[model samples]
Target chain A: MNYPNGQKKQINQQNKSVKTNNNIFSNRGMSLEEDINTTNTYYLETDIAIIHKKPTPVQIVKVNYPRRSAAMITEGYFKQASTTDYNGLYRHRYIDFEAKETKNKTLFPLANIHDHQIRHMEKIVKHGGISFIIIRFAAYDETYFIPAEKLFPHWHDKLNGGRKSISYEKIKEEGHIIPFHYQARVNYIKIIDRLYFH
Target chain B: MNYPNGQKKQINQQNKSVKTNNNIFSNRGMSLEEDINTTNTYYLETDIAIIHKKPTPVQIVKVNYPRRSAAMITEGYFKQASTTDYNGLYRHRYIDFEAKETKNKTLFPLANIHDHQIRHMEKIVKHGGISFIIIRFAAYDETYFIPAEKLFPHWHDKLNGGRKSISYEKIKEEGHIIPFHYQARVNYIKIIDRLYFH
Candidate 1:
């Protein structure tokens, strides 16, 4: 289904995997967000990469202080992020990218991204910063890293009144399939080493 | 005076500079926060450095959408930041720092920093990141870049039940004074160069 503004809503789209009833999933071991976070922590610990997930910005109103030291955030709403979730220095270069997961088995909808974020990513690329989007096809159990440069053409085409999103088949052909490893969970830098550094 | 918990109020006394109007005596020129942000932007534009101020973490409790496309934050409270404001890459080294301004002429009080933040700074330094604090004495229009190594000893002394803060005099003697420039504004990288690079 398309949003009235022709964009797909995903930012706060509660993952069905995170079952509200008891917080148990179909034994995928860990949620996509949790695994990526763990991988980032591991990267930081090993001095491999210094990426960090920016905390979800929340608009907090109405706090209750029952005790002097205890403050409860009684009311708050999540704010839209101005930039991607992850960024940091890697191998002396600025690394910035966003992580996304989709359950679609066919075409990976381009509707997943907001226009402003695409523009922001473009700015990072223009300034010689390494930029990309990490896409995980949950149904296929595969993840791909699509370089910003490659994604830019498609983004431009949309601006020229073309299709606004990339297809899953196109991503499979152009994007680097991130290898899964026990240690470097996402192992995105391997793609970086070949694409940007090499 | 001692607080109800028998913990000496120490430096927790009311900021004597708060005027009868409940407004702190802000500097006549741009605030330190603004100055640092300007300097970071300049650095980014010139490719001299790639530092950025982390967005102030706010918990939004309420927002009034008086008109479409306009979000007016009606109620919110600021949250403590988990990382330093300024962090990015410089000449293949990870740079991380926090900037604070004080009106106090006698001493640059340590009460301004939380213990957890000090611990975080220490971790950054331990991991080989160039970490420091930019302290602007707004009243005198003087700013100093104090290395994390120097600040650590004083921070620990308080934990050992010694002095609770570092004096302005000590900072004047030990910290590198940052020179101002038309373009660089804060020119803190000059201090960083002399202290770390050179």
Candidate 2:
């Protein structure tokens, strides 16, 4: 399928062992990450907002200074970020969020997010900034914009002997459904406008 | 010298040819950066703020998958960041800024800051966030927290065929002088609280 962004969405092959929801339109190859990136780029290119996905943090252990120029990192490790994958200014407000994709149709596991990330989000919310998660049920090719408030309960519940994951049905009912667009594939900001701006 | 952070300040060797102000007590080995990093860490541990310096952005060109584990990047290049060095949430507002040090005591060169970074700061300011530069005049061992508003005129001057830098005398008059603290060496946030909160 061709998106308004003028890019053709490549359908990805599915595994027979996993449950597939054929009812929803699947734009498989363009992962949830790619969609969000594309959306952010569009947002930036237009001057709507100055949002950016932070570069994957790397801890450089060793570097080689071959000349009086840019030092080349020789040894490094992909440092697990203490914060979210993306954060930037939106509508004059601080915005922070994480995006994840799961094949499971019934549940979105809390394990996909790190403990530090939860704390980071909690701080943003406490400070009155916006925090959220973008989850893609890849099997069904559906995505949802769920605020941090909806997510915090699931994290706390794990300790209270509650379900370790949020049921898809619960999320569908509580979360804002992100519509797929031709240009802005996962246009999550539309929901933000309604939730916060209005 | 032992700082209030309970750490010894490591003095960096100075280039003799460069300008040095002997009257200002120089923590010779401890660069301005080390002080700021130490301060930030202290802030985080004390639950003051969750600010962080974004890792230097690097572009990975080649990677080697030696085993079924971590991918080792064999080739990469440092990418100039379009945004500033540090940013985070402060009192429910987005804070973004850059830090620069200069040996020249008379002036803070406009060349040190990029054009895009100025634009980035402008956007942050326009969106109700705080944006500024923490300029450390090494010779004087003096740092100034100048808001984007104060810095913008200097940027615009260059385009109008005016002088391309801000003189130290002018900066001293216009900027908030950041006092050197034992623990929070670059306590720029104190100025923020004064300027924004008060």
Model 1 lDDT per residue over B107-140, tens place? 8888888886787677677666788999988777
By TM-score, how accurate is candidate 2?
A: 0.84
Candidate 1 whole-model C-alpha lDDT, 0 to 1: 0.74
Best by DockQ: 2
Candidate maximizing TM-score: 2
B1-198: candidate 2 lDDT, tens digit per residue:
333453233222444423243223344456777878877888777777778888889887666787778877766667899899888888878989999999997998899999999988988898788999998888877889999999999899997999989999999999998866667878888999999999
User: Lowest summed lDDT over 10 consecutive residues: which window, candidate 1 chain A?
Assistant: A18-27
Off by over 4 Å in 2: A1-27, A65-71, B1-28
How much is B8 displaced in model 1, in angstroms? 44
Kindly list the per-residue Cα lDDT of model 2 for residues A7-42, writing each as its tens digit. 223223344322243223345678888889988888
Candidate 1 C-alpha lDDT tens digits along A116-186? 67876776776667889998888776789999888888978988989866788899999988876565677
TM-score of each: 0.68, 0.84
Considering the true interface contacts (CA pairs under 8 Å between chains A and B), give the fraction that model 1 also has.
0.09
Deviation of model 2 at B190, angstroms: 1.3
